[model samples]
Structures are given as C-alpha cells and as structure tokens.
Target chain A: MGISGAAFIAGAYEHPLRVIPDKSVAQVHAEVAAGALADAGLSFSDVDGYFCAGDAPGMGGIGMADYMGLKLKHTDSTETGGSSYLVHVGHAMEAIHAGKIKVALVTLAGLPRQASANLQMGVTDTPEGGFENVFGPTIHGMYALAAKRHMHEYGTTSEQLAWIRVAASTHAQYNPNAMFQNVVTVEDVINSPMVSDPLHRLDCCVISDGGGAVVIVSPDVAKGLERHSIKVLGHGEAPKHSDNGKIDLTYTGAAWSGPAAFDEAKLTPKDIQYASIYDSFTITVLEQIEDLGFCEKGKGGEFVADGGLISPTGRLPFNTDGGGLTNNHPVNRGGMTKILEAVRQLRGEAHPAVQVPNCELALAHGTGGSIGTRMGSATLVLGRD
Target chain B: MTEATAPVMPAPAPIVNPENKPFWDATVEGRLVLPKCQNCGSINWYPRVFCPECGKFGVDWIDAAGTGTIYTFAITRRGMGAYGKAGPYVLAYVELDEGPRIMTNIVDCDVDSINIGDKVRVVFHDTGSGSALPRFTPVS
Candidate 1:
C-alpha cells in the first residue's frame, strides 16, 4: 500500500557551474532537465509529470512545463523553500503509485548569488510580517537564534559545530565543481568572523547560481530504461512551527519526518549507509543528526567530532559530493542537491575517493524555510535494486 | 566597553493587516495587548483573530504584563537591507510573564551580558508613522 518500490529514480544531473552569470534561471532548468532525461535514456517528450518549486522561473510548475515543452499530465508546484525538491520527489512517487503518470521530471534552478541583494531585501506581506518584519531578522540572524539556544540547552560548543564544516571540506576536496575545495581545520572555522553570534562565516553555505534535475519513473517504465535505477523506499514530510510562544529550539521537524520515513521503509538509522543532510549552517547538521536518530538527542557534538562525518571511516559517510555546506546551494535551495547525491551513492556513481564501498541504502533529508522560524521538513529513503 | 548602544536600526514599517491591526494599534498608546480566546481562554502571540487552539472567533485583546525574561537571543554581527548599518544588535525572544513569548530586540544593555532567563520589560519605540514597535530592555 506504500510507495516502496512503486517508483524509481532513473537519472539525476547537477549543473556544474557554481555561478551562472550568463544564463537565465529557466535556461539552467531546461539544460539540467535535458541532461537528466538523456542520462535516463529517455526523451523530454517521455516526461508526463512535471515537479518544481519556487526556484523555477515564471509560474513554477505550469510555467516550466510550457518552457520545457513537456506534455505533462500531472504537475506539482509545492513551494517549501530549499526542501521543495525532496518533497516533490515524494509527491512524484505517490502520483506514480496511484497510476497518474509514468515518467516524472523534477527540476530546481536559481540565481541567488547574482540576485543576492534583491533576494535578501524581498519580504512578502504575510499575517505575521507585521510582528516579525519590524525586528529586522536576517537569514543568518534567524539561524543564529536557534544555534545559540541549542548551545545553551545542550552545551554544544562552537568547536563541535566547527567539525561539520570540517567534514564537508574534507569531502569537497575531491569535488571539482565545489565552491570550496580546500580542507579547513577546526581552528579555521572557530577563528572565522562571526556573522551572527556562535555561527561563523564558514558555518554558512555558499550561495550559487546553478540547478539540478531528477528523472523518476514508474516501476513499469523502468523496465524499458537502460540506466541503473534507485528505488523509492519511503518518504515523509512534516512542519514545525513556533507553538504560540512555546518554541523548542533543540529539535527539528526531522524528529517527526525521519521516523515516519524509517517506519514505512521498515528500517532503522543503523541500516542507512549514507545520508545527504541539509547543511545551510553547521547548527543545522548538528541538530538534524540528533533528530534523525543517528545519535542521542544531545550527543550530536560527540558523534560529529574526530572525523566522524568523513568518508570511508565514518559510521555514516554523508554528503560525499560535499553537500551544500562546501559545494553549491543553487539559488539557495538545497533539497535538489541532497537527492542528487543520494542517487549517486545508491547507483555507485559517486567519486571513488569518497563513495561508500557499497552504498545499499541512503537517506536524504531537507529543511525548508528558516530553522529559527516555521519550516517544512522532508525525508526520503532510497535503495538499490 | 560594550557597543550595545551602537546604532538602533529603524525597522521597516510593518504591513498592518486586519488580523493584527488592533495589536499594532494598542502599541501606539504604549500598551501591549494579546489575543485571548473567548472559548478556550488560551492566549496566543501575533494576535490572530481566531483562536488557534479552540478554533473560535470573538477573541478579546487583553492587556499583557509588559515584563518578561529572555528565552533566547543572538547578537547579529552582520545584517542586511535597512539593518546593514546597525551593528551588533541583540535579536531575541522574551517569554512574557503572561505566558506568550514574543520576538523583539533587547536594547539598553550590554550585548555580552544578555543571557537566557534574564528579566526584561517592554518599551515602545515610535516608528514616526502613527504606530509604535514594542522592544524590550533589561529589567535591571
């Protein structure tokens, strides 16, 4: 009755450019779409379902469907910030499970680095804008609030948080397209200038102008494909908001989403061979690791320390493609890259230096919106056939 | 030597809406009011018209105790847009005595001295455009 084995991710393509100054956002989206379709040994005309998020140019899914000339029978324009693509992947699986479409195409693209000023200044008028807008909470400021609260409540230190950036850098060394390639030490992270209290500049992800696309197909459609397909084992999504005034900064929506996903997959955290966690900030990785049941609630600091997240030797080798922390957070949306890496690992297509020996099961988790405020979280479990 | 008094960034005028108009209106008179559900009696922040708990209308704006304690805070060293020039400001949420926590800036104190559970009281800052924004200052 579940989506397990109902759909397969046939192809994934991450646009190589970290900064695309010459190309438009829609152009990047189209390029990645073509690349993924070609990799899957399918044509653009084969795609019957289109999935995108706020990053897509024009009117999201509908607009992109037209731009890509995709004759889609189904489309989803679910906007969940950076986690939109992960959520879209889950939604695509449900559609395939229900026999709505055969070949589903999911894409994300943005130029946040080029439009940094406008993106930061742009504020939508929501019901809560009146109360929050007047406080001038920047993106860094919002995440810093959560980081400070976690440190206060759990005794998480800046040195421990620095290790996340270190782990990411360690893997980024092998990624030719990574925005940061040099391995950084704990001292480098600790000594970096603080953008917000407790969160150093290195703790933040690089803003890039790139895009990625994934081709998901029904199990029936996969029989005709030549590329190795990764099975959709389980998916879960949830939201965590400030409960009136009672807000707990110690945990994330992953606490709910991760377990729901594992339950459906009939697996535990121990079974996950790889994880592609959203890394918008160091505190994000630390908190999600705890919430994902990788370790005890307050023991993420110890779990992530001493080269624990480094590839080959770590208990769970994560973000082998360097992840958003060191590679690219295209258009500031990281959900797309999370899935791309997990697919790479499951297909044994990752760089040999950082790839898990036999990555059987992988988990990719994404948190959309600000961690200090309300957010949509999505978790996906994928496996090799 | 704390530069906590560094420049107070004038907040961009809030987009006042019907759901939160009364809450902003009360701040002009230097009074803090919270929406209390007439059905469940549970209070909520952001002054919503309907009760988030009981799902009923006819909520009342009750006067709130202006005093609270710092639940959490971060000293933002860098800011964007209008806050770009305002250096080293303490952005925080204070758990009000009335039980609802509110997001506000903690002014008139050393940034390094502010900690979770520190007592604070609300102070109204006139926005020069008919409404006032409620900020907090250390109780001590």
Candidate 2:
C-alpha cells in the first residue's frame, strides 16, 4: 500500500489575492475549496473527505466542514504548522487507498499580515514552553541560528544564501499575483535590514493574507475528471526536536523525511525535474536542498550559487510560483502553496517564464514550526504519468 | 567571572510544572542542576522525570559546573512579541560540562563579539518568582 498511483491531485487552486482584509479566514477556506473542486470539473457535493490544519477556524476540520457544507465520511485536522497541508496530502492518499473515501479536499488559509499586530512569541504553559519561552526565540531568530551554524561549520556565506532569494524573485517576475514582483540581486539581499544575524529582511518570505486548496481523488474518481491529474508518487513526514538539550542546528528533519519520500517514490533527487522547496527564508531553501540529497550536506552554498536554482538555465528549478519568498506566505503556513505549485508544474500550467520544460516528475517539501528548535517536515513526490 | 550587577533582560518567570520544579528550585538557590538517569547514568537537561536516552523513570539531580562553550548563537535585531523592544540580544546554546546543551542568553558582553566555541560560565537572573533563569557570560 504505497501512495504511488494510489491517488491523483485532480484539482489545484491558489487565491489570486495576496491580501484579503475584507474576507474571513473561513470564507477563504471555502473559496479555495470551491476553486479546487471546480478546477477538477467537480463540485463541493463530490467531496466526501475533508482535510485541514491549524489554519482552519474554530474546531479545525469540523468547523470548516460545517461552514462549507461538506458532508464527510472522514476528516483530519493534523496540525504541523506550515507543513500541515503536505501531511494532509499524505493522509488523504492513505485514506483513499483504504477506500475510506473517493475524494478528499485539503484547504489552507491565513492572514498573518492582518494579525501581525497580535503576533506573540507563542510562549505558553506547555511542556517545552516553560523552558524555551523565557529566552525569547522568534521565528527569524530560530532560522538565523541554523544559518549561523551552517556558515560556521561549512563556510556557508550570506552571499551563498542570497542566491536562493534571487532565484525566487527571478521567477516571481512573471507571477502577477506575487507580492514582490521585482527581481532582486545578491547585493540587494545582503544590504537588506538584518532582522537576525545572517538573515536579512529579503531573505525571509512575504507575509500575506490568502488561501489555497487541492483536491485529491482515488484513481477511479480521477479517471472520470475532465482535467489531467497529477499522480501521488510518494510521501513522508518526520519531526525533529532538540534531543533533550543535545540539539544540532546544523541540519533539519528533511534529512529523514526527504530520503523516506524518494525511496518510496523509487526515485532519486536527480530524477526530479522541478521542486517546490518551502521558502520561509533563504537558509530554509539552502538546507532543504542539501538534506533532500540535491547536494552534499555542507555543500549547499556551492549548490545554490550562480543561478543554480533559477528556472530554465539553472540546475534545479524551484518555487516557480515565487514560493513563500517573493509570492506570499499566507497565514505564515507555506505547505499548501508548495503542493499547489508542484501540481501546476506537473500539469504544465505554471508560468511559462519559470515552468520546467518536459517537466514530468516534481517534488514538494514543507517544513512546519521552527527549524532552529523543533519542526515537522513533510516531503511529497508527484508525477504526470 | 560574574557580572558586576544582574544584566537587565525581559526574563519572564518560567511556567512551573511538576516535572521541572526541582530544577527551578535549585536555580532559586543559585545553582544549576540537571536530571541524571540512575538506570543509565546519563544526564539530561530540562529536568524531565524520564531519561530520553534509556527511557528510565528513576533519576537524580546532579549539580553542574555551569560552565560550557557556545554551541551556536544569533543576534536578534528585532525580538518577538513582548520581546519586540528587546533587540540586539544574543540568543545562544551553551554546551555545559554535564554533556548537554541548554538554550540561553549570552549577556553582559558585546553581542557582536560572541562566537561559537567561546567559553562561558553561568549566571542567574531572578524572574521575580522564587526561581532565577540561568544565563551565561563570556569567560574573560
């Protein structure tokens, strides 16, 4: 019972708005769900399984299901921060394979920009919170720690990490819906305000308010759809934590999840023509590109240097939708958008300027939570067969 | 080396729980203690009841030398939430002599001069609660 060919991502939709001040989070969820189902040539009535993450309002999947009028036989509200949607895709594939349901709808939405004033460090009365919250570890600070360590150990320079943002911005030029459509240079990133050591403001993803959805279906239901569906080739997820004070900031959970995904897909990193590497920050992409076996562990700097990740001319084209970097990081969760871009690439519907030619096999990887502390990482392999 | 006075930081009182009360109790007395698994003889940080290594329920508190080298650090120019105004601080992990690293702040020194492998010793910042948060300063 593998995910390979077990399910198809028949529908994918991304909200055109990067800022949705007027709409409620629940409304965005419903809108994306409808867009995805409509893309699949189906309607909300066809969805029998609903999947969501912490981004969902109220009781998670239960609340969204009721709001959307989704009569479901099965539902999942697994929350993994940013990577929740990728996890949902995997869970949906398993459910479909088990014959639990024929069609599953996964939705994600957030308005962090609108909620920015109220954003807190998220310290609370949890098990690890008492110990960690006192020190004041912001999201930027967490990734900055990893970046600093990676540089100290591997001689990774801030310039090398800058290439990732450059690549994202380069592709973003053609994405009309992207928040930042202007192409930037390495010098630009290096000169940007330092929010945290080794991480400039441009190195981080844009905060926006929007949502996206993907409709996954069993092979039987997929064959009846009017649009071509991307095959679910493989899936993997893993959690990386501080190992009881023996924390290693040099790597991420991608080291475990990426291999598990590639092995299940019976493919190698070299086989992937396009990738949707989550871009919470520039260092985020560099580390995942290394851990995903695209390059050696400490060789990420060289791997991404000199247009390595730029589309068409680059070695590995990634985040053609501008990713969370230049595009939008809705709700501060990027997993859903990662899957949407991969689906677009496999279907050859990505922006022509950044779309990989003859693109057949693509991989999308997402990291939820902080890479500096604990994180939930998920990887997926999708193909057009 | 000790700071002439306690460095000013937004040291919030840790939410005390049953599992970590002993560790905080030691801090209030101006000491750093770690949980040592009696079954495996492995020392763990954060004072967990069970050993993460051997999965043993029995453990003992061991006083630490409270001196370690910096593992990694980042200077946050803009902090988070309540820490939003507390910028230009060094957030670091200090690898203690007890074979475990603890997340802490490296204070009372130039933030720009802090680096990995710099030796540091522990100092306490009273959180207005009974317990004090253990931080580190560069070994001059």
Candidate 3:
C-alpha cells in the first residue's frame, strides 16, 4: 500500500537566516526550535524523534539529540542534498511505521549572512573534503554549466532566466526578510556581472547564515497541539545521482517521485491551489516542473514564459517566500521555507501580500545535489482536509 | 583531470567514484565521455557504475559526439579562490547532439557573441595537470 499519515503541526522560521551574526549552527537550531515550539504551542517535552537537516555534519540529528536531551528513540540525520528536510519527512514516516514515537522535529540553519559561512570559492563541501574541489568545479560553475545547457537545448533566453529573478523579486517585495526586495528587471539580471560563464552573480544563490525549524506530531497527539494541523498527505523521492553523475542532464528522475506522490495523495497539478517549490535556482524549478509532471519536459521553458509561473495570472503560484534566489539560502533551508509557507497557507496565515485564497492544496518539490548530474528530488503535497 | 591552470584546477589525486574511473582516465588523456545503461538503454552522467533509471548495475562508459549547442551561459566578471584570476570566463551548459546537456565552459570566441542554440564543438584547454580540460568552442 502507499504511504499514508495523519494531522501534523508544522512550524516555519522565516527570519533572515543571515540575520544573526556569530551564531553557531547549534545556536541557530536551538533558537529556531524554541521559536518553532512556541509557534506550535508545544514544548521540547512534546518532541520525541529529532531530525536536523542542517548542512554541517555535526549538527544534524546528533546535534539536536545533544541539545534537547532527547532519548533518541528514532532519529534521522539525513544529509541528502538540499531537499534533505523534505527527505526527513520520509524518514520520519518510516520511524512512525516502526512505532518509534508520536512526534518529530526537523530544523535547518546556517551562517551565510554573518560571513561566518565558509564561502571562499565553491560548494559547501568539496566532494567530501576537497576530493572534487581540486577539479576546479565550484557549485556556481557547475550550475552555470547546467544553465547554459538548458538554454542551448530549449532556446531559452537569458530574458527567460531573468523572468525567474523578476518573479522572485516581485514576490520578495512583500517579504521583508527578502534581501533584494528592490525591483530588478530582466536587463538588470542580464547586465549583472558574470560570476561564471553563462551565470551572473544574480543567477547564483547567495550564501547566507540563517536557521529554520518544523515540528511533526502524530494525528492523535497533533489534535491537542496548537494551530491548525496539516496532514503529511504524501511524500515521494527519487535520485538521478547519489554521489556522482549517473544520467542525462535533461531527462530527470524527479518525475518518478512526483507521480507516486500525486497518486498517493489523490491529487494532480490542477488540484493544487498553490505550490511552494524549491528554488535554488530558476532552472531547478524549471526542470522540476518538467519532471514533476506539471508540464511536458521541454515545454517547461515555454510553460513558464509569458507570465505563466512568474505571472500572478498563472494558476499555481510558486516560492511564496521569494525562494532561495531572493530569500535566505542557509544551506538549503530554502527548501524548508517552502514547507513552512505551505503550512501557513493551509492555516490561512500566508503573508497578506501574496496569500492565495481558499488555498486547500499545495505542492513543494526540491532538487538536492550538484547542478549538472546526480540530482535528488522530493515531492510533497499538503491538503487542508 | 589535468594540470592546474588559471581557471581549471588539477585533481590533488585521481577521482575514484567507481563508475567514473573511465571518464577520469579519459579526462587525464583529454577525452569527454558519458555512460549508457545496459538495462534501460539510458544515457546518464557523472559516470555512475550503476544504471540510475532501472537500478541495474550493467552500465558502461561511452564517448559523446563532442558536438552540441550552447543552452545558457554566464560570462564571469569575478572569480573566487584559486579561480580568482579567471574574472571573465564563460561557464556554459552545452546540449550534446546526443540529447544530454552538459555543464562546461565555452572558449575560443567572444563571450558576448555567444547565444543560446549556437553550434559548438569540443576543444581541449590544458589544466596544466598534464592533460587538457574539455571545453566547448563555437563552431565556425
């Protein structure tokens, strides 16, 4: 049978993850968790299984285990690419299946803003300790490579790429925490000094220091918890590469994850009222839209054009929090923000500036891994019912 | 894969991810390669030892056409770390004629004149490691 779950009380910490200066990853988690518990009207005692998706190796589940003094009934410190927290839901569900506990906590944080983040050149971790670093392939360069490939194949325009930045910037206007709220046009995106070939500084995701957390309680326990509960509904995942590139860059494995999730949730692209997609980059969302069965594969660029995904007139709005591009990307906490916004919309608490009315259903998807190959994607659907 | 240059860096040692040994070998020798899964007939990337689509282990390496088009690109005005000297370079995504798009750098032409869908062919840019890095050049 397909995976099924009950009511969940979730929390989202949207503070400028880069806001705090000198906060350790652990401090970020503790602060985010405390804020999350307060928002959920619950205390640390209510949490049983601890999960931390923070990028730093030491601060995942073990970090939380040390912090809250959790007995560690069932803990998952899954450090998959960026969509890791979404993957946490999958692990948490398995723990529940194993009868480990009734409540679970997931958190993410980093120091991109404080300049404490190790952003000397490329990716956060270089192929596990400089293995790939010496290759001269930084994360931005890899992504820059992918972006150029996407453009060449589909005849996608830099203007088209700018469309994503424009959409995000427009969305950021309402989100005070968003760093670049000032309106930036397509010309601005194109003119921005290039960081790598085909990738401008604006095209790349900024490294910032920030943290966010979410709590998941069983249906039975969730009923007594504060705030309107959102059921897990369904979760699914797939990978094109685990440690190395394994498949064609165009066709993706995320499509496999999306269909299973939609089938499990009994929902479709049209069924969703809004979507909070992971936005590490504009192209990441473009490819996921293709892979997630939202639109035909190559047609993604066209589908998103002409105010489609970027246009407010489009049916399904995305990345309600300005996404990783404009918002804080504290080690893929960008993905966590997607879930956080989904929870708020389900509870009818979205920012008044960009809230979708009667937002009963939503989609949150992520691609975690290097830009070129060996990607991981997770699809999740949330419903108010 | 090769010697360290101003932009491209050399591997401190050889890469050994299991599936991509051949790709690295070819890189050290200055050739671009990809993988075709035996079970699912899928062409995949990053040189995996197993098939990602069918979960089958019967996969082998194959060389690409070395011909493709520019999909998108960024002309770097700034560089970081060891690459700090490479302020104005074109990091490109090239769509191979065989249907897969690869992340690579574009060379041998003015970065401004390059646009999406422009024809490109593979060329070797020495990494100074002893082998040259595979880069794409606009086909005249």
- The model with the greatest lDDT is 2
| C-alpha RMSD by candidate, in order | 1.2, 2.2, 5.1
Count residue pairs with overlapping backbones in model 2: 1
> Highest DockQ, which number?
1
Q: Write the per-residue lDDT of candidate 3 for residues A214-291, one digit (tens) a residue.
A: 777777776776677787787888876523332345555577878878887887887887777777767677777777
**lDDT score of residue A260 within candidate 3:** 76
- Model 2 Cα lDDT, one tens digit per residue, A1-385: 3557799999999999987889888999999999999999999999999999988998868998889898999999998889999999999999999999999999998777676544345667777787777888888888898999999999999999999999999999999999999999999999999988879999999888998999999999998888999998999999999898889988888999998888889999999999999899999999999999999899999989999999978989999989999997888889999999999999989988888998999999999999888899999999997
For candidate 1, the lDDT comes to 0.88
Give the higher-lDDT candidate: 2 or 3.
Answer: 2
Question: Candidate 3 lDDT, tens digit per residue, B1-140?
Answer: 22122343322343345444566567666677777888888887545657657888877678787899776666645545655565466665567887765556677676667877899998765554444456778898
Q: How high is the TM-score of chain A in each model?
A: 0.98, 0.98, 0.91
**Model 2 Cα displacement at A26 (Å)?**
0.7
lDDT of residue B89 for candidate 2: 79
DockQ of each: 0.73, 0.69, 0.31
- A260-321 per-residue lDDT for model 1 (tens digits): 88988888999999999999999999999999999999999999988889897886788888
